[model samples]
Target: MSTPKLYAGLKLREIRTNLGLTQKAFAGKLGVSLPYLNQMENNHRPVSAGVVLALAREFRLDVTELSTDDAERIVSDMREALADPVFGPAAPPIADLRLAASNAPALARAFLDLHRAYRRTHERLASLDEALDTKDATLRPSPWEEVRDFFHYCDNYIDAVDRAAEHFASPAGRPGDPMRAAQEALAHQGVTFTRADGPWLRYFDPDTKQLTLSSRAPGSTQRFQALHQVALLAQNELLEATLDLARFQTAEARAIAKIGLANYFAGAALMPYRLFMAAAQETRHDLERLADRFGASIEQVAHRLSTLQRPGAKGIPFFFVRVDQAGTITKRHSATRLQFARFGGACPLWNVHRAFETPGRFLRQLAETPDGVRYLCLAREVSKPAGSFRAPVRRYSIGLGCEVQHAGALVYADDLDLTRSFEPIGISCRICERPDCHQRSVPPLERRLSVDPGKRGILPYEIGG
Candidate 1:
């Protein structure tokens, strides 16, 4: 029987085009020659295990995707091509062809790249199809959700580092600078740092066994780099261990979880849990002074402050949230048992939205829900790191809040008038049954609308009035 031809070549070409990358550029990125890339795309090669692993690591791709059935089919096709008897005496033996496919480094790399591209395309198409089939297509996870989850689970831990910094800053002789200690810790782990010129100046070279730290300065972002290094070393094992425990079904899910756990560990490592909690209690959760002492961003300080809710050693009871200019909640962590609406839209009149208009300036407000539960909020715009001038994204505005009675503890409420009536807002339109709210993007799924012209309300038309 004739061997069934695999369209691996076509898939490779399609992915290259989809990413708008030239054959040469793709080859360079993969650390392979153009001819080798072309040969793999043409089904003149078979993938090997090492190259498959390399593709997964380099592209942050799923390993299962790189070792698909399509790759097996391509291998079958190559075998059939070698057995054809047309070339006669000058033709290489089938054994020779098999050896070349198996041993040739370039051919192995090409096959791996082709397989990886195919897997990525296949998964993307499947996600789109699933999105199309769902009712209330808009109900599907938004880009904001993905971004927020990425940060949350990926364990981006500036919180932990800042906590560590604060912990060591006591009267019993400071343990050098927290940043210097972090740097020293990284060096102890055999990770060397060097200044480089690039958008991603910091990259780990597994081959050279070096973690190069970039010198790109966003004003006071140097301390962040130091903390990040500490995260790489101190939190690496913990992050890996957490991911191992997660046992995610898909490689993609596992990859994301691994990143999240790493960030979490990073935060935990930076802020030794016990010390940070103690400091929070002592200062009543003053973010500015906390940030100053730890050399961390305010957002980092606030996030750590919220995590001090351990069973016995709790600090201030608070909730933390981060939103962009579009009022999208990118990060939400709460110590209180308050229910937060996960999807739909957020309130535009909230202090979080107002903070974006006055970037870098902090704002304070007292918010009260229908249940009469009042809270104090501190909102400020946190600048997003720009990758390049051409693709600039908006800075984020994050809000940190606590119960109204705990307002005196925060610096934001000290100067502001507590009696002023601020706009009342909810987490999202679906959970919030508030009528006449102009910010309502979509009505609640469970709420039935009444359409009487005379009795029509402003926002939600009244559920079965």
Candidate 2:
């Protein structure tokens, strides 16, 4: 596969400005002409190896920060935003989109903001006249989506929160049960806890200094809720600080993000990063074994595995996704080149869909994304049983995978050939580039289609160039 070019224009400019260096002086220091430096700074030219070396030597910069992460994120979000039909068939080419994301990152963000506003306004009013008459109509990213993107760009790991959770779980400078620690800490705070069969999962009555946990919930889930409440009660400042840095557009978003951070803390605490990483390595990443060892559910283990991105000590960069029976992506995170569709659902061709048919068993797929990057994907059904049989069962399929090179680390990839027999997969039909997919629910917005009444193939109509 071809490697994507790097563009660190924004980062380079920030570093230069932060160091208070003139463009001419910076160019001289980097052994490049002023015009050449200008081109690189503007992303018209790739930063050269000599320039990279110069930045490291002169500024003590961590060259790894010069990754294409920012540009890639912007490009992915822009692609999804542009897929909206309001943009029509006149959307810019992928090459132009990349240029905009790389060379004018701020403008690209502004465009996304405008699109978010357009959507919010469109949802609020039925007609243009109604829209014009509304006095308080404002545009902002949907709080939930904004938070999702925030975590997405963060590579699904909040270092501070994760470390704090690890610390909380580590009593006496040793790994211990976080749930027990939370209980002990709460007791010291004059808060008493109890378990009961109830309609609510957890209820904390601050006035009475009582926390009620559901007896019906699974042990792992109960533990998670306990830790989540602990995070809210004890770590409010840290959670708020993280959200403040995020600066979400709406209070609802901020509230939702607080819960998300607590969930992160709960998961991290249940499986302390260092101990969990060691166990994962020892077991070849066997989900069941890790879950048993950490006293976490398989789903929790899978989710935590995707968040092993703690800089320098990063694990295999895996993508974790959970889809309900309807194929909607309920939860997702990826640190790899492959990105999931922001709208609609996952590719029907992917094994995640098939996981529902064979419940209670793990399914494996050697799959390739539309970009030709391959992954060794694993999928299994996770079911939540209600207290009584009369209540509904919440069922979802969990998927976890990393690129082929990292397959060796997974126990699931024991006998499979890493290089061949890969199934083709795409993000979603709306953005998928494949023309002959039989399971496509919709034609790609990026391509035109032709209707051939007399001819038929995997697709009912031929795709136009």
**Best lDDT among the predictions, by candidate number:** 2
How far does residue 340 in candidate 2 sit from its true spot (Å)? 1.6
Tens-digit lDDT string for candidate 2 (273-305): 888898999999999999888789999999999
Instruction: Kindly report the root-mean-square deviation of model 1 from the true structure over all alpha carbons.
Output: 22.5
Q: What's the TM-score of every candidate structure?
A: 0.60, 0.90
Q: Which portions of model 2 show Cα errors greater than 4 Å? A: 15-38, 48-64, 123-138, 171-173
Cα lDDT of model 1 by residue, 1-465, tens digit: 122232245445655687799999977777778898888776676444454565666766543333223233233334323222332324344444444443353584354344434434445576776644544333333333343433433223233333444453332433336556656767877767666656663677767767656565442355556555565566666455555664544465666655554455445545556666666667767777777656667887888777664433456667788877667676776544233444433566678888878987888888875435677878899886555677466589888888776788766677767777756776555445566667677664334566666774565366531
What lDDT would each prediction earn against the true structure? 0.57, 0.86
